[model samples]
Target chain A: SAVISQKPSRDICQRGTSLTIQCQVDSQVTMMFWYRQQPGQSLTLIATANQGSEATYESGFVIDKFPISRPNLTFSTLTVSNMSPEDSSIYLCSVAPRLGNTQYFGPGTRLTVL
Target chain B: TQLLEQSPQFLSIQEGENLTVYCNSSSVFSSLQWYRQEPGEGPVLLVTVVTGGEVKKLKRLTFQFGDARKDSSLHITAAQPGDTGLYLCAGVGHNNAGNMLTFGGGTRLMVKP
Candidate 1:
């Protein structure tokens, strides 16, 4: 399992602002994914971030709203732009290491949009 | 697009009781994984069942995959208050990403001592 960490474990932001969540993995990985878990809901894939390429957003998720950056194999960032109350959710980053089909997740960034 | 439906959306049981949680899907999955999540923390993977009709046990928790690969079940024996948490079932999807996961609605379990 990879040791993953997300910065600013929790945050409070006003509507219309943006916050960038960083995910750092202990080892270099090729596949990094961002997922959102709404209050009392399941996890939904927001995007797939691969280093040296553009992030692929999932259905109903626009790149404009959830911009992602995979600057390196071990680090990625997801920026929630133009936030709204509906965007209040736990944002998590997962890494699929080179060895297996399993993924390891970060503690998650809990965002509260006011 | 595949979807996984979890049964008994919420379960509250007393300690020492046994309970089962189900995850069903109309579409087959290449693999299924079970995870337990506590407040303010990310889900911790419990077990992964790949082959159909396979059963794996971890301590007091048992995980089984259906023969058709479209369903799975998790049974815990002699449950303890420490077992209380949100249980999630995720199926591995065949996608370009290779390991894309389709998560179930999730079962929130509360065990009272």
Candidate 2:
């Protein structure tokens, strides 16, 4: 199992401000993913953070709003730019096991835009 | 678009009661996973069903995949307070490999003492 750590466990940002969340994995991983979970809702995949490449985002999401970067196999960052109250949600980073597709997730970053 | 539809969006029951959550889709998948997430924590993998008609048991939880690989179910026997959380089912898209996952809306189960 892989352990992941995310910085800024909780933050209160003013509207229009930007916040970057960092994810650091204890070991190298083949795949890393970013997810968002609204209060009382399930998790939604935001993008797939690729090593040395632009993240692949899902429908209803765009890179300009939620820019992501995977500098290496064990590290990635997600920046929520021009934030609004609606963007307040728990952001999580996950690392997938090499052999199977099982994912290990970070504790999560809870952001509340005021 | 691939989607997983889960039933009973919210459930509340007394401890020791039994309940089952369903996850269905029109598309087939190579693998399906069950996860339970607490209030402020990321989801924890409960079990993974990879083959059609597969059944896996973890403690008091039982997971079953449909014969067609288009659906799955989770049954909890003798529920406890710790069982209260958001239950989610995710599957790998049939056409994609590790690219994306279609997650069920989720079943929020609250077990009362």
Candidate 3:
């Protein structure tokens, strides 16, 4: 199992502002993913932060809206750009140390855009 | 698009009662995982079921994977107040890479004393 941490446990941002959430893993992981959980809804994968490469984003999500950076195996950051009230959601970071391993989630960053 | 559907979106039961949650999908997955999440916290991995028809137990919780690899279930025996949380089932598609997962709509369980 891997331990993961996310910064800005909770934040209130103004519309049109941007916030970047950081995720740190205790151990080097083979994959890092960013997710969004809207109020009373399931999580939706935002993107897979590839090491030293552009992130792979899911449909309905775009790089211009959610930029991601994975500089190394143990660290990654996700930026929610041009925030809106609709973007107010809990953002989570998950890591899988290896293939077939359980993916561990960070505490999650709660964002409220006003 | 792959989707995991969980039934009984909300469940409230008295302590010591037993409850079950179901997750179903039309797409086949290589592996399925169950997670528990409390309010304001991230989902914690409870167990991962890989092989078809696999059953894994964690104390009072039991998880089973369907023989077709398109469904799963979580059963909790003697539920407690501590068991009140959101239960989620996720799966890794056979064609997906980098261990990406598709999460099911969660089941919110509230165990009353």
Candidate 4:
């Protein structure tokens, strides 16, 4: 299992503002993913942060809205741009150390956009 | 799109009672994983079932994968207050990239003392 941590454990942002959540892993990983969980709902994959490359986003998500940056193997960031009330959700980062290994998640960042 | 449907969206029971949560999907999955999430925290993986008709046990928790690989279940015996959390079921499909997961609507279990 990998030890993962996320910054800004919880935050309240005004509409139109942007917030970047950072994910740090204890060791290098091959894959890192970002997920969103709305109130009273299950998690949805937002994107896959690829090292030194553009992230692969899901169907309903776009790069302009949830931009991701994976500068290195152990760290990544997801920025919720132009936030709105609808964007208020718990953002989580997970790391898959290798193929066929279980992904470990960081303590999520709870964002409330007012 | 493949979708997982979990039953008993909300379950409230007293301590020591037994309960079961079901996750069903029409599409077949390569593997299925179960997770438990507490308030204000990310989910923690409990177990992963890879083969069809497989049954894995962890202490009081028993997990079973349907023969078709399209369904799974989690059964807990003698539930405890610590068992209060949201249980989620996720499936890994053959066509998904990077082992992307499709999640089921969670089952929120609250065990009273």
Best candidate (score: TM-score): 1
Model 3 residue B101 distance off true place after TM-score fit, in angstroms: 0.7
TM-score of chain B of 3: 0.95
Looking at model 4 chain B, report the run of 10 residues with the lowest lDDT sum: B92-101
Candidate 2 displacement at residue A55 in angstroms: 1.1
Q: Please give the DockQ score of every candidate, comma-separated.
A: 0.70, 0.61, 0.76, 0.75
Task: Label model 2 with its docking quality class.
Answer: medium
Query: What is the TM-score of chain A, computed separately for every candidate?
Result: 0.97, 0.97, 0.98, 0.98
- Predicted candidate 1 versus true structure: per-residue lDDT over A14-97, tens digit per residue: 999999999999998878999999999889999899788888888999989999999999999999999999999999999998
Interface RMSD of 2: 2.2
Off by over 4 Å in 2: B94-99
Worst 10 contiguous positions by lDDT, candidate 3 chain B: B92-101
User: Tens digit of lDDT per residue, candidate 2, span A16-85?
Assistant: 9999999999999988989999887888988888889888888899999999998889999999999999
What is the C-alpha lDDT profile of model 1 across B1-113, one tens digit per residue? Answer: 89999988999999999999999999999899999999999988999999999999999999999999999999999999999999999998856655688999999999999
For B1-113, candidate 4 gives per-residue lDDT tens digits of 89999988999999999999999999999999999999988899999999999999999999999999999999999999999999999998633346778899999999999
Give the lDDT ranking, best first: 4, 1, 3, 2
Kindly list the per-residue Cα lDDT of model 2 for residues B74-108, writing each as its tens digit.
99999999999999999876323364567899999
lDDT (10s digit) by residue, model 3, range A1-114: 888989999999999999999999999998899999999888999888899889999889999999999999999999999999999999999998986567889999999999
| Model 1, runs deviating above 4 Å | none
Q: What do the candidate models score in CA lDDT, each in turn?
A: 0.93, 0.90, 0.92, 0.94
Better of 3 and 4 by TM-score: 4
Which structure among the candidates has the greatest DockQ?
Answer: 3
lDDT of 4 by residue, A2-31 (tens): 999999999999999999999999999988
Over 4 Å off in model 3, which ranges?
B94-97
